[model samples]
Target: MRRSGVVRGWRLVALVAAALAIAVVGVLAARAVLDAPALRDFFSRYPGTTERPEAAPYGFPAWLQWQHFLNAFLLVFIVKSGLQIRAKQRPPAFVTRRNTGLITTKRPPRRLGLHVWWHLVVDTLWVLNGVIYFVLLFASGQWLRLVPLTWDVIPNAISAGIQYAAFQWPLHDGWVHYNALQQLFYAATVFLAGPLALVTGLRLSPIFTQRDSWFTRRFTETAARRLHWAIMVYFLAFTVVHVTLVVTTGALRNLNAMYAGRHDESWIGLAIFAVSLVVMVLGWFVARPALLTRLAERGNDVRRMK
Candidate 1:
């Protein structure tokens, strides 16, 4: 017989508990090993962070705070709507594109599920925000802070990873520079994973699929679908680890730098962070099918799929 929902939920909880216990024990064992004389000497030699270029940027700018907030806000909705689209195979309502632009002559009106329409809308906003972020990141010379400038970063990143795994996170001032591990992860998230998601998502989108070409035939829809799902999982995992580290390492200082654009130990950053969380939670609940169908019907023809 198939397992009931309650039984499955309990099983998931037990599985998560077991994983956490294993992780704790593993970290303790690694800590004991790293405390040995040989490893201690290695740690002393490499430390956890390499020296950054003299021209590297410092301090979180006000624009960065706004960008951070917008990115987070859009991401919450994007992920929520994306998951909704994925889970609900037969969308309750469908939306046919409204043709009005000059480009509409090239491509006819296309029909899509209401959930998919929501995902696409949020994703477009996220991409636009990312474009603005990239422009500012380069214009302000903040790219130097995230992209590694030397080969020494490899060893330093490894050292930082060791430190993190051993329950000894590297100490660094975020207002000035991030440790090697943080720098590398940030770079990968921004450049590599972000583009991967965009590319894969586009491959599965109506604009690309509506046309037939060598590229479309080679990159199958099934592959794009699977890769897109994997990218989402990667993003979710990254967010969990990033938030945990931010809170555990230096919650107040980090929050202040990112949210309030200040370097003080005040509680303003925490307050802002709490407010952002509330907004995200409200967005999660407010994005229901009933509300979405009504909103989507304003511009496009929305119909309940019989």
Candidate 2:
């Protein structure tokens, strides 16, 4: 039976609530066990340090601040539209006239055409932003801050994990230093997850299907789709944990660094963050299928003209 939109919405809410409840229970249990003498000894033995080579100055530049904002903005739209596309359950609204010969298994609803269009559009923007970020990061030599240079990072990351489990936050000076765990996570997000997402997305595109090559054979559409979904899950989990730590550990200082490009603990950054958040929320409301369809049609027109 086809469920009403309200019923589906409630189901989503229930699922999210269940997940949060499980997370809370898991955290409490971990905390109860994390402080045991054996575990404490193990953590102390590691005693991780945040040492890095040729570290840049511990301050956010104007460019970095703007990049951060753009990344967050693009990510929000990408994730939202991506989810909408995934939720589709009937045939595509329109099919290409060209015979690309790509398999189409799932029949998505007509409305999903808009979702897919928005997802692709925002994904392109996100990739461009990432490219710019990479160039500037390496050029400025700030990549050292995220990419670990030593094998000790593994053990140190474990120690950092223990600290987090015990509710004792690690020292965080993001402008200057990040704990071993933070460094590893950031490195994975940048060098691994980001590239994997882009590659998997491209693999699903018609452009890849049009060209028969060893690359396409190795990364089949099915594999690409599954990996893309997994990447989305990873991003969602990372965002949740990252935000929780940011707010719980030190909101003011973190906000100051990212938003205001300052080290001081002030409300200015928080205010700016709040305004930015409002804009994002407003965007979320206005990003309807009708608007997306119009945008997608315009894009198609431009492509044909080209």
Candidate 3:
């Protein structure tokens, strides 16, 4: 009976996640029925509304520049607020788990004062950021940048995973142009985070509660928080990978793409973006132990043949 209950819990989570994904796809499709040139069309409309100069070729557009700045700014803020929510700690407060015995895991108190208030403010900004950015992504013909646009991405992530755990390199550096891990993470961010915000908002909304909506029936705010915690695994994973590479490469260069949009004055943030990318391909150099393991195994095989 206890085992059965665990299965039921897993099934419920899968069902809810599926429902959220479907709802998001439906909403995006309905919005696209308008079928303006593309997502870029929505933001392109903005250039004319403001008295800004037109974007230079291959240069960051005015709106795009502000968007990046805003994105990076909010990213830092969200990380802080997220930590305050339950900084560096994760547990019952974060996710729901299966337990048969009377023993169950618990979260430690991380009494970050004003965490309660900060959560509200940070999340509200995130929601606004999503709505506005999705609109801009649609208008700017830049969806491909966020989505997994290439087949190599999955294989790349697997290779990157191998590197992370066992410090092994499965393929030559030239085999992949983009860091497989980065591509996959960003792709999921678009698809997964997009829907999470909506469902969580509904689950917490007073208006929805008053109307006895589906969110109210399916999960309480506490349960919704748990779901949000599970989704946060993606964010946590990305942060680790992001920080590791930033320091592993050069903080200046990585900061360039994120800040001025380039390491030096040249072409803004494009060059460091390119270099930081190249650094991932050479990550095998940093984990020399993994490299020696493969060579040693090869030598052993050769000696056995002799």
Candidate 4:
């Protein structure tokens, strides 16, 4: 189960043979479509023919807005809290730890513009982002697609990794199934990062900061800062991996579908796009019971396979 034909040093070169086959087939397919008047007419009717698709349902636009707000929040909080906490250090060992590790010990914290008012501004955005994210999870059923329900998930993920790395795929599932890393990442973002950011931010707030609330309130502000930084690092890394995966596999085909909401298999792309619709209307409908049943069935299937 652990072994796969895709990931290795020489397999990349070995895969040249298969790549050539694929390229030839692709060229032929392109020419056939190009020469056929019917195909041209059909594509004319569907300008997004395997090239462009829409991803409106992903809430990419709204998410982008939220990201902007988050960046502003981070900037305000980091700067305002930085000046206040840095330099001389404080009662909590973290102030020293943060400055020493993240910043060189050579310099003191900047005192300029270090004020309480800006701190409050930072806290407000943290609260606002918490509220927005809670609503986003409910409004968007994106939670369903990313979570791993089956025990087979881990093995499958590793298998997918090996195959991809070896430059071959042993199991060509109809859908481009997610590997383990993707599932783990998506789940972590949904369940861990969002909540942690909120809790840590609030805990650092002077209004609610307290020794008794150290676990959640007045929690290690430095640790929270570290966590926030880590999340951004993860986000940046994921973006690179995601783009690289799309390109290595097939950029134009997948990107077109994501952008315009149409792909080679129109319905599949539509269904994925429809995830956004489900997000918006998930709670209002009475279909929760049936959805639960379907989830249960899927769960049972996984167990059976195991």
Candidate 2 local lDDT, 116-179, one digit each (tens): 6567778888999899999999988878888889898898887778668757776667867778
Global lDDT scores for all candidate models: 0.87, 0.77, 0.49, 0.47
The TM-score obtained by model 4 is 0.42
Tell me the TM-score of each prediction against the true structure.
Answer: 0.91, 0.79, 0.47, 0.42
List model 4 lDDT by residue over 107-142, tens digit each: 443322223333444556655665675566556754
Top-scoring candidate (lDDT): 1
lDDT, model 3, position 126? 64
Best by TM-score: 1
Q: Which of 2 and 4 is the better model by TM-score?
A: 2
Q: Please list the Cα RMSD from the true structure of every candidate, rounded to 1 decimal place.
A: 2.7, 7.0, 20.3, 20.8
Tens digits of per-residue lDDT, candidate 1, 182-250, equal: 999999999998889899999989978888999899998899999999988998999999999999988
Model 3 poorest ten-residue lDDT run = 47-56
lDDT of 3 by residue, 1-306 (tens): 999999999999999999999867765654453344663443233211112123312223446546655554555545554555556332112211233345343542222223333344456776777778778776875554445554655554554553444333223221112355655666576668657855865564433444565647777777877776666666667668766765554455445545453434344455544554455435323423233234334312211111
Ranking by lDDT: 1, 2, 3, 4
